[model samples]
Target: MLFIFGISPKTVKTDQGQFVCPICKTRSAYEIKTQRNYFSLFFIKLFPVSKPRESAVVCLNCGTHMPKMVLDH
Candidate 1:
């Protein structure tokens, strides 16, 4: 018997809002994303092995990920 199993991270867009990008230093559209770790078997997603709601803020223009403090402002 042979089986291939591994964990993969998948990022999903959850929300969008306007924010000032620290890296780009400009007001732009930011996307809120959540990363979920999935267990894969035979190249197919079987189940999630970690928390499915880890979030991040991404700048649309510069494509830089911002810290959680960026969302507070």
Candidate 2:
């Protein structure tokens, strides 16, 4: 059960394939991935970390960005 509910910020999705800059509509963009590793402490039991998920986001044009909240299991 605990293994299902993970972290924040899911993946990157674009409406036009290329993310449009909020300020200007342009194809120019860049990607950045964030990786993290940590141990989870619980009162019932001690669990081992299986794998670290790669959370990412991209800035389309104007450098404006939003974080993805949920993901499919």
Candidate 3:
């Protein structure tokens, strides 16, 4: 018998909204996401294998990831 198992990183979007991108300097759509490592079996995610990473604000237009503090404005 053969078994396949591994760990992989996964990022999930938690929220989306409009915000001013610090780099773009304009109002644009942004996504709030968190990343975590997960245990995988046969290429399928089974469970979390590591702690959740810091959530970030990703600008859709510019594809730039900014700090969560950007949402305050």
| Candidate of highest lDDT | 3
Candidate 2 lDDT over residue span 11-36, tens digit each: 33333234444445555664444544
Q: Model 3: per-residue lDDT, tens digit, 1-73? A: 7889999999999999888788989888999999999999999999998898999989999999888987876
- lDDT values of the candidates? 0.87, 0.42, 0.91
> Where does model 2 exceed 4 Å of error?
1-19, 22-24, 38-50, 67-73
How would you encode candidate 1's per-residue C-alpha lDDT over 1-73 as one tens digit per residue? 9989899887889889998888989999999999999999998887888986758899999999876679787
The candidates, ranked best first by lDDT, are 3, 1, 2
- For candidate 3, the per-residue lDDT at 16 reads 97
List TM-score per model, in order. Answer: 0.80, 0.29, 0.91
Ranking 2 against 3 by lDDT, winner? 3
Model 1 error, position 63 (Å): 1.0
Evaluated against the true structure, the overall lDDT of model 1 is 0.87
Q: Could you tell me which 10 consecutive residues in candidate 1 have the lowest summed lDDT?
A: 45-54
lDDT: which is higher, 1 or 2? 1
Instruction: TM-score for candidate 2, please give it.
Output: 0.29
Off by over 4 Å in 1: none
